[model samples]
Target: MNSDTPQLKSFRSFEARQDGDRQTSRSESYLRTGRESSVISATIQADSTGRDMSIDLDVSADATHLKRFVVSVDFGTTFSSISFLILPRNTPPDSLDPHILYHHIQTIDHFPEEPCLGLAESRKEVPTEIWYPKEEYLEDSIMGDGTGSDDSPEGDMPFHLQNEDEENTYWGYEVYSCQRIDTDPNQNRRMGGFKLLFDESELTAQIRLDLEPTLDMMKKKKIIKDREDVISHYLKHLFSHAKEELSEKHEYTNDCPLGFVLCVPPIWTPKACRIMQTNMVRAIQESGYGSFGNCIDNLFIVSEPEAAAAYVIESTTTVLPKEAFMLLDAGGGTVDAITYTVNQTCPLRLEAEGVEAGGALCGSSYLNKAFQEHLSARLKDEDYLERNGISIRSIVDTEVVKFENNIKRKIDIIRPTSVFEFVEIQDLRADPRKNFGRNRLRLTHNDLRGIFLPVLEKVSGLMERQLELAKMRRINVTKVILIGGFANSPSLRSFLKRKLASIKSYQDEDIPLWARRRFLVPSSEPSTRETGRDASAVQVMDFDVMNRSILMTSLLTGESFPIASLWMAGST
Candidate 1:
């Protein structure tokens, strides 16, 4: 709990005085600084609350001796992850190396099944999904069981849980697997997209229709008592898994000093941010962190875009002095864009107020929706299959969606002949119609483009708006950095490159609008070459938020003290 750390005394000693007298003393101190007169005037105006501006630079100079751990949680809309750095006793903070310093907690390691479709390798992140079995089904299973107790036999529990309640309450991978196998949707209630409900305006009619069943189930079962409870329940499971992993890996004790930083969308209003923070604090407290003695006081909130900027500025080698750049964080639920001007390169002083900031609800999930709609339309158009009483919606959801998610990553926009064959349905096998020839779905370049065009257009528009603002401010934005889960989309990357290239070459009556901006994306593989002390040793992780969280954790813990000072000054 650094919040209770002692404040620095003023350089000049003074006797106890009234509030008015203290304001006069602070104004006098400001006037006596002998710096720029405008700066002094601005300082006085900024401190209207009469709070002290002094800071003790050496407050954490001796903190290196303390045994502590820094942890960051990215509670994302589609998937959530946690990354952490451990500072052992007597380890000097300055000597820490980022290349091997951070570790992803791998939250879904012990899941009953793999989480997402086509994920062959183990992943550090977990699906932000939960499933609640119907009360009738639970009761039936309990009555049918030979053992009356809630406890299951060792090694017989699904997901290896100790109690039967956990078996009925599934999360992450189990939700997906259960939904696919059990056609009776009422048997298990699976819930996703609850994260988007934080902003009420973003809750569309379609989204509401999709969430109604789960919401009703949650209410009836008391799985979620309120909107905040939805987030708290998920977070409690996430943190509990993280605590177990950390305790085993580092042998962490109850007394170990631990700090948690949570990342939120930059475009969230102050009200939304406060709500999220309150729920997060409540979640941590209810997760049994309170027994560890004031651990909750160490919680910090950082904007997602700000954290991404910190990582790009510190980890990249090509970022130039005074160079401006645009960051596009296209996540599952939203896309946020921010433009930054680097004021200093050595200690990294970035413009606090961005040249422009914008966001939209259009994200990668919308592509899936569009694809689902397209398939539904095709099924509707072809009457040959409907005559046989085949349900098109079931075929699309259970079969087509899985194939789409897998191949969407490998789609080549330039290849017009690239075909995606639909998984054969036995009902369609007997119907030999021209439209259903070979039981294959032919995806032309235009068809493929159509699937992604709606989302890509929204993203491109956001970037264009940010670029226009930068131009209006006369900022020579040098680079465009892409991050988040949607950044992994090849179609998105290609679309942006083509769109930006056109804008760069577009002659506005012989004036190039955006000729100098360079597009940069994170490489999948880590670099092996060392850049020495002048450059950061941290290699970018596959997960963008994890990398950003690592940098944010370091910044918050005074490892990069000067950057923190600059951040505070900029906030003022």
Candidate 2:
């Protein structure tokens, strides 16, 4: 992973060739050379096996094509999102303004309707859920178009149905948001929360047993042939939808070569990343957007935290050079933390080599699980359950989870005395009087604190450990930048600010709080005022924006440039 290694030597060779041309700028060099020269190759040496794997990349294609776009996919455990950055052929890479770049990093909000349910919806991120059709409906869906042949032209059928009938599956928010169907056992088995399973080095006997049913369903329906196929299936749909968006909304033609930058957790091993990349490549190939060879050549992988740091450094006006800062990516499935020292400001180099990194599975999804458990305990009355013919699990899943997802972000963590009222559950049962206290569930300050405190504490502990490591290295960490969906939690922000502010080193008694350190969050300002079907949701930092920043970094640093290379090489 070091820059001096043989793998990087190939990268350096490519850079040298690009720099040798005085007549053309580095970005313009691709225009003079043919498609063959646009291709760049890098080798990845496996740590355990010492096998060198060659990765062919077309990093300079953006410079060659008349129109190029970088499609960034932030594939998460609970939700998945996509964004697009159009690199206009006329604009030089170095001359491209940051403000203009932000304008092109548009979030994809609209998603295709489910084939089975025929329901359409628009949202910022699609729920990473899929449903298997029953045998009868499956046949009808597969052969409904009269031809009933798998060889039908892809253009003839619906976008989702372009693939082989057997491989076609239903997905999107409608699949998960729809009411539970009880008619068929396989009618609505939602497949999600399985993204992390791929990262496990080995599956235990019990784990394999638990996953049998889902795996069998996937295989039986011909939706996927194997475990890795699940990712391929999901990504196929995602890439297809993104292509449709670009064509219809952005007026992109097929002549434009598309580049992709996929974001993954920093904690994932090289093998895990390779597995993801392999499946994603298969997905892009099957998506029919372009040839498999061309798509794979343009693909790149980036760390989520590094991408977040890139966005913060470029978008925010407060960050300064040579200052050490920590980036905490509090995502849905995992929390990843990494410290970066700004090495340069002009070209923006944040060196994260040899820095200690920390992470845990205690993400926002766990808080939802905790809330479900809390509700179950409170509603565990046998008599009440029997009379109402209602299950605690159903109430929590349908009612309590919604409240937690929507209201938790709005809660003011500064005011500990405040209480959150939940009257949404009162209508769960027809008999309002039979429910708890006039069909209302009250959550005291203590209850609210209890729900999120444990997870937040774990995150806080991760930050503390990272800070301690920075201190041990004699690196003065001065700022913390929070990103990802879960980082929007007011309670989590308030907790971190309060907890980190009080700590003092044994040697520094007189250091002022502001001078010692600070916490930075992306501004809530909207990036653009473009009117469209799916207007981007305003947040501190949209995951898509971070993704675009990563894409920008890749173009500036070259395809062979590794983010946090030193740390990744040194990490276990």
Candidate 3:
């Protein structure tokens, strides 16, 4: 089996100076550049000392010709996207042609005499869509072959749709959207990030309790027996459809090969991760990407935030000398925080921090809850006339599916109120029952802002905590990078700038110098606050830090990872 360990490399190696003192507040000043043999011997001698020791995993490619590509997939619960990067190959290997004394050479094929140019391509967007097809059987009265009869058990199922080429297609986003939702709307109100009744505590157990009401509602409609049964049936249907599509789509039915990297949420627990991975593997196999009836080698899992990080990191030219900086990924599913550091002598170091709270979900959730409250209130004000008279059963029983007066209207009974009205009825609406229950509610921008404020606060607190931790460890942060769909919000950026500035402004004497040194006060001020005086000189910038620091640190260290590794190990 091939080794799957990812490449790790750093740019610098540290050596103790003759003047180095243990009592000094700082770690040994890193070795000055251009001093090779002298520093290497000193480092080796220092390593022999009886003390705490550590190793770095700096990885680098050899001088040999090679290519690299980075792929980023922005996958959300409801939607997904993909991006890719193709790296430039450094140098082509020397090749020998048939030694002919005659120098004259002419080819009928107008192949360019110049070497074939290799191009590295990077894609920035891949949609996250998976589709499956329903199976079909022939009519029982069929006079010919056994495509199955209408009276046969399999005949009644929906047949999978054939692709344009008459091959079945799966693994795209279109397929996922067309499938029937398995859970009851009342039970698992999850559309992307909004889980109506998700409580962190009692994770698995109460999940069903929260789901039962919706399941019951669906059961009434004869969608499925219970919530469990509904999901199972839905999965079975999807799996069957995917398999059929896969079988029909490709010419080589035995070879279903797909290359993919999945992005999961940062806060996902091991158990949750396992469940999700299992489901994904099953889905992939059913979709025909599995080898030997299983999904293994073809699948790779990276956190959604990490995928964004990889995407953004590769886009930058600035590399970090210290190789340490806070990474904030504000994406659709969640906001993830990570600290990444790379030094000449050490392997890439990464640590994940924070939770998933960034995106439109929180905003949308607040809106949905507000709307529900409005509907309930309207029902009460009308002497429960609307709620009592409108029969969900009748709609399901008759399968009316009417837009004006059927299920859609019933679902829409409760409307969300605007911020203007929300503010006007703030006190009145404080009574949860009367406010959110009524219909005809519209949430204004202010309401949306108010709902998002708390979430922003949580994110701010997390960053502050991370800074404090780094200060304790004497790690200097050079830049703070943010990416993802939510990061595109101007309001969010402004809010973060203010909060970060406030944190940086802390002048407490007890604060460590490392923290102060790392703080780069943002130049932009909050639009809401008027300031006559420019506060600090710290220049704040947002861009690709990895590429920026690379050259600088590479110069600082005499050689790159591959060369240094051989030299470092060969010395002993």
lDDT of 1 by residue, 57-94 (tens): 22232333333566567676776666554443333333
The worst-scoring run of ten residues by lDDT in candidate 3 lies at 558-567
Q: How many residue pairs clash (N, CA or C atoms closer than 3 angstroms) in each of the candidate models, in the order given?
A: 0, 0, 74
Q: Against the hidden reference, what TM-scores do the models get? A: 0.66, 0.66, 0.42
- Tens-place lDDT digits, model 2, residues 436-517: 5545566666776778788889988987888788777777777677666666667777887787777543244221212111
Worst 10 residues of 1 by lDDT: 557-566
lDDT of 3 by residue, 431-527 (tens): 3544352333344444444445665666556666666666566666555665443444444555666666645412332211111100001000111
Q: How do the candidates rank by TM-score, highest first?
A: 2, 1, 3
Which one wins on TM-score?
Answer: 2
Off by over 4 Å in 1: 1-68, 90-112, 115-120, 136-163, 200-217, 247-256, 269-271, 285-290, 352-354, 380-392, 414-421, 424-427, 430-444, 505-572
Candidate 2, lDDT over the whole model: 0.51
On a 0 to 100 scale, what is the lDDT of residue 29 in model 2?
26
Models, CA RMSD each: 17.0, 14.7, 21.2
